[model samples]
Target chain A: MKAYRLRRGAGRTALYIAVIAVSLMYLLPLFWMVRSSLMSAGEIFLIPPVWIPNPPRWSNYTKALTTIPFGRYFLNTMKIVVFNLLGTVLSSSICAFSFARLRWRGREFFFALLMSGMMLPGAVTLIPTFLGWRAVVPPNSYLPLIVPAWFGGGAFNIFLLRQFMRGIPLSLDEAALVDGASYPRIYAQIILPLSKTPLIVVSLFQFLGVWNDFLGPLIYVNRERFFTLALGLQMFIGYYTAQWELLMAAATIVLVPPVILFLLGQKFFTRGIAISGLKG
Target chain B: MRKEEAYGYLMAAPAILGFFIFTLGPLLASLWLSFTDYSVTNVYKFVGLANYKRLFSGADPFFYKSLGVTLYYVALSVPITIVSSFLMALLLKQKFKGRGLVRVIVTMPSIVPAVAVATIFLWLLNPDIGLFNEILRALHLPTSQFIYSETTVVPTLAMMNIWTMGSTMLIFLAGLENIPEQYYEAADVDGGGPIYKLFHITIPMMSPTIFFNLIMGLINGFQTFTQAYIMTEGGPNNASLFYSVYLYREAFTNQRMAVACALAWVLFVIVLLLTLVVFRTSGWVYYEGDRQ
Candidate 1:
């Protein structure tokens, strides 16, 4: 199709124009976010909205963090994030290894069955699960938020890891089996080492999910002591509804980490997304 | 073989057990609880469809309102995101300088958490001082109340969602990549123009991805919560009372556990039926090798 392709002239310029135009539509709002974050409260609502702030207010970040016990919230969020990340990575990989590498009766059947579990609305399980946990633990407990990771992480995560694991050369694992090495040993020493890319992808996804999760913390933790960044920002919304500068600052704080994480893991993120979407 | 089988079960036990306990058990329990008036007191009486009856019998003020609001959101947002993201993918598929940077910028919003996106949009959509209104005013275009206005809430929310559809566009890009080169070559040989190629080849090949995005979009859209819950709180006389919000308020705020359970089942069924309908009519989806 190179014979007919728009290799030059107005068409190439048109593609460039379209690309830059679309890119701007996404970037402009975020640019506004930073601008608003740096603005003084009075300036936030100025007519024709101030595009550039003279001497950007770096104080807003400090004030935003200090105003709402955001430090405590960050620590609280990190606790859930760390534990959830650990649980998800460990459990989901083990499960995926079974599905992808191990041959067993009803393997394909059970895998399909688990994948179908994604269709079940979280709402269906949400109430009963809450009741179960509330009965077992006190309010404001992180158990409800963290324990789900220990189970199987999530169906999607398991499927992702399994898909990645299935692509590994079977000969290495088969040689271990031929040498009478146990399945666990093979998984631990060979399969896990070989599956680092998907592992990172899964962990990054899990980190972002737990970090950004609002409803879980909302339903589970009622106290200020238990609030994650999401809940804290939510509470900030309530408290600083009129304070646009602080609101933008708080929102930006919550927004930045995940974007940084995505940037750091861009390659893996694309591959992970591609595999999950197309393979599904 | 038996040893291997046992090991497989052992390895997979956590997920399987978790599934039953967290997913399957609750699914059954929710179904059962939907028939009762269970509350936070941990005591209940089986109301025998009273809750569900209340839902459909015009007794529940929020039921229809929330459903309509969410469907309006889903209907608008799903298609908008699908077409826009597909177009984005198409735009990026062409060779261009700085396309990599453009790809990063396009996908950046998707990485932003929902709450943050809502906050940004809240400021951007603020009738008085938001950037959007400023732009609209500058362009001499009519500016509405955005998420604040009852009439415009759903559309505005839907529009904001389109901004963060980077993942959906990536899926489309992948689908675009998978199209056999020979088909495009053959079309070129037959003097088929780009427009003809897009209609005859590209759309058919992409139907499955489009379908996938549609179903997933609907499922996710119907559950629109974080943005609306944080921004609107089902306010402005309940114009933006999404079903998920209504359900959450019913369960947590109102202590209507059984009713919420019923709501959950209703969502499941609606999604299930929609998925089935899509699948049933998905004759346009061109699966490679299926015909042969």
Candidate 2:
């Protein structure tokens, strides 16, 4: 029995060692990012890379901000992201409720059509979508970005929320109806309350999509000042091609907030993904 | 009936309108534009089947080359992702201290914006003075210009994809949880060891999640764009030119909308077929409560 206990202890130790190694591998790049961001450009490319900067240059952060119209881009991204988040949440939840709870004509067909949208490659429609946006909105407006989220731009979020909503009991809706509540009221009160998890998940996805979206901004918003952090960060690579410090510093700033958000909200996000099978 | 119809439309109005204008409208317009010699500057002449013919005939090097590269990426990324994710999932499933934290850390790379992630990785894997090479030098191991090399670029990009395993890991974890503890208990009672339990019970039980991940991964893999756009710009010899990147170059950069559309339709058919294959094969998947 003692020998068996020792064997189990050994197994546990072995497992932990393996995990520690893997974790280090996972974190190495991030460690590198922060370390390199602090070094002078000359020191950054020292033959033996500096693992730690003895005198970390704090100016990289400031230079990164100054190099591009970082403040303007940040504001643009926030504006676009906020509106996109609101639009997606409203559109996806309302549509998801309809698909999941409300009875309708051609419901299955429409549902299937919506699902088919998920299957269509965005590449197929890139040009047409661009031209379509051009036709609808005057060039360089946020309409192209904001309007789609309001419309259910893509069906992934709505479908995910729909699946989540299906698990909600129909009795809630029926009871609300019987009690002289309107469908909208029931949706606003009962369904929305119950849908907090999926709604948060959809909102998070929309936020990430809008916040991180470079392609949309690149295509529609050609003005340098209107660039998102992602596009603005890309400029650091070019403008300060040799300045690893400023670039890394800039990259870190853009990268960190979303990551912090993910870590904090990971549990809810995981629950959403685990349930809906949509994150992939 | 009219009232009910009105309510249904009212409920569905947002999604339908979004779909029609954003997707369906664009899809139809793109299709029409495909039949024309349309550039952003040029008001397009009807050049029916010329672009389509050029694509299949391998007359356009970009079309064929990008298709090949895209296929290569799909082949490399999907399998590597599946195997690595499965292995990592297995490791996480084991009882360990700080398992929760480790899972979260592993999932971190996925949520970080792709552009940012690519930038960090681009620096980390830089040929000179990059940490990856430094480690190799310190250990007296060999390393090369990974991202810069044509031969090595795709595989390295695929390796970076392992970080995006949070979504898959969550699925695998859920699948692992759903696996009844009784199966393991029975295995133990029958003198089964960890290996036996893993092979006989864990895999079969996890097959559904695996299937879901497999299909979704393939679809996502085929549509891979941003990484190619950011990391290599499809090249040191066009080695990393993914189809979507190629399509972008065709339509926007080169103003070859027709050819790009042809390529997109091909991709659509390919993805559809792959999804169908997975669905057809799902019959073999085992479920706990399911009966023949």
Q: What is the interface RMSD of each candidate, in Å?
A: 1.1, 2.0
Instruction: Go through the candidates in order and give the clash count of each.
Output: 0, 0
- lDDT tens digits, residue span A239-276, model 2: 87667788888889888878888877888878866775
Model 2 per-residue lDDT tens digits across residues B140-243: 99988898999999889888888777777778887788788999999999999999988899999887788888888888998898888988999979999888
What's the distance in Å from true for residue B1, model 1?
6.9
Which residue pairs in candidate 2 have backbone atoms (N, alpha carbon, C) closer than 3 angstroms, thus clashing?
Answer: none
TM-scores of the candidates, chain A only: 0.95, 0.94
- Superposed by TM-score, candidate 1 places the C-alpha of residue B82 at a distance from the truth, in angstroms, of 0.5
Tell me the fnat of candidate 2: 0.69
The per-model DockQ list reads: 0.78, 0.66
After aligning candidate 1 to the native by TM-score, how far in Å is the CA of A82 from where it should be? 0.7
Cα lDDT tens digits, model 1, B95-162, are 88887888889988888878888888888888887787889999999988988788898888888877
